[model samples]
Target: MSAFEFVFTFYSLMLGLAAANVGTGFADMWRDRRAIQVGVCAPLLAAIVLVATMNLWLRFWRSWEGVEVGPWALITLVAYALPLVFLSRAMFPGAGSTTSLEDHFFQHRRVMLAALAATPGFSLIWYAAQGTLMPDWPNAWLAIRFFAPLALMALTGRTANRLGLALILVWMLVGLFR
Candidate 1:
């Protein structure tokens, strides 16, 4: 197999696992739909979907040309995928009965936040390591597109979460059109 295919297989596997985990979490939530809090569950669910979608897009955008694939690059890429896995796990309750999805979310809030926070940070490192940080994008668009969600995540209010979700949805819609 080619180097790109070889290296990408591992990355793709992790991404698939992440998506499956998120899907399982959604199923669990649906199973316990009575316990879902729209205020909390909606944003968290949206973020999970966003992460999975973005990871898929990232795989498409990533290329193996003109760059050396070494231990460090592989390590960085794996590290980048780690946060998604963690976030997926965080979103779901353990096996067996649980109080509620909201309760699970509150109990694992820090883990969820840490995992979410790590995604952009690790993504920055992964892109930088691959020498694709700025490619052909305008700096302002990159900053707003990448950093805005992180900034929104810093807020701990319901309004902030709703706004953040709206921003992400709008941004994603624009991307689809483009």
Candidate 2:
């Protein structure tokens, strides 16, 4: 296989696993039938969708004929994928838990948000390193979409969390239209 294919195969696999992990978390939450904090679940679910969407977006790069794929490019891709997996796993505390998903989410909120906050920086670096962030799209969207959550988290209020959730939903909608 070509270097690009070889590297992307692993990248895609990581993203797939990330999506599955998030799906499992959601399934657990649904099956458990407990009160869920919309503030937490909304953005967490949005992050899941965003990660999966990113995997789909990567498909477009597979056809970029002349871009050179090197060892560092592979490394960068892996770096971008790792936090996604961590964030997915963080979303749900564990399997077969009696504790409410909402409680687990509150318990792990800081770690989960830290992982969520790191993903965009890693993604931007990977894309820039790989020359994949198209000039046609203003890079500001990356900052607006990714950092907004971190800013809200830092603000540390119910209003901020609600605003974060709204931002995430809006971001998802914008992604859908793009």
Candidate 3:
């Protein structure tokens, strides 16, 4: 593969790793097995997803060359990241403990489903906004990415769920506007 392709693949994998980090919240959730599991897994999951995102960008980084400021990838990426921010907030339980886990979970379920549901729309926007040469790829990949959150929404509850929802909302919003 070309250098760009290599970098992209590596980053994509890293993104997957970071996405994997979300799983840690699950491990943390369990009362008995929570500590070890979450402690080990959460960071790992985040790492995976983070890596994946960066790699994905690397793969497409060239697309930025001579490109305008506002592309679908940029919008989608920002939108996607927003949910993670909120989810991190919901999960961490900092100043805003009032946002219950249950609420988060319910919201997560809705958002994830919405994101999956919204795929076509997001794809359309991505195509129109970005003037994409490879429109089909990103849209398809997004559907693939939806799996983790979908399962998490179904199985998880409490804080994890809420975080999941928040993340999904970000996903949805990004798709909608992009």
Encode model 2's per-residue lDDT on 79-142: one tens digit a residue: 6677778877776656666665556655666666666656567767666876877655435556
Highest TM-score against the true fold, candidate: 2
Question: Would you estimate the TM-scores of all the predictions?
Answer: 0.72, 0.75, 0.40
> Residue 70 error for model 3, in Å?
5.2
Q: List RMSD in Å for every model shown.
A: 3.5, 3.6, 9.6
Better of 1 and 3 by lDDT: 1
**Candidate 1 lDDT tens digits, 31-63:** 666654424654455454555456444644555
The lDDT, on a scale of 0 to 1, for candidate 1 is 0.61
lDDT of the candidates, in the order given: 0.61, 0.62, 0.44
lDDT of 3 by residue, 1-178 (tens): 5544544454444444435445544434443242222332233333333443443354356564443333543565545444443333333222323444434334444553443334334544566686762637555556645564556646654566446545654554454334
The TM-score of predicted model 2 comes to: 0.75
- Candidate 1 Cα errors over 4 Å, as ranges: 35-61, 67-69, 126-142, 172-178
Model 1 / residue 116 / CA error / Å: 2.1
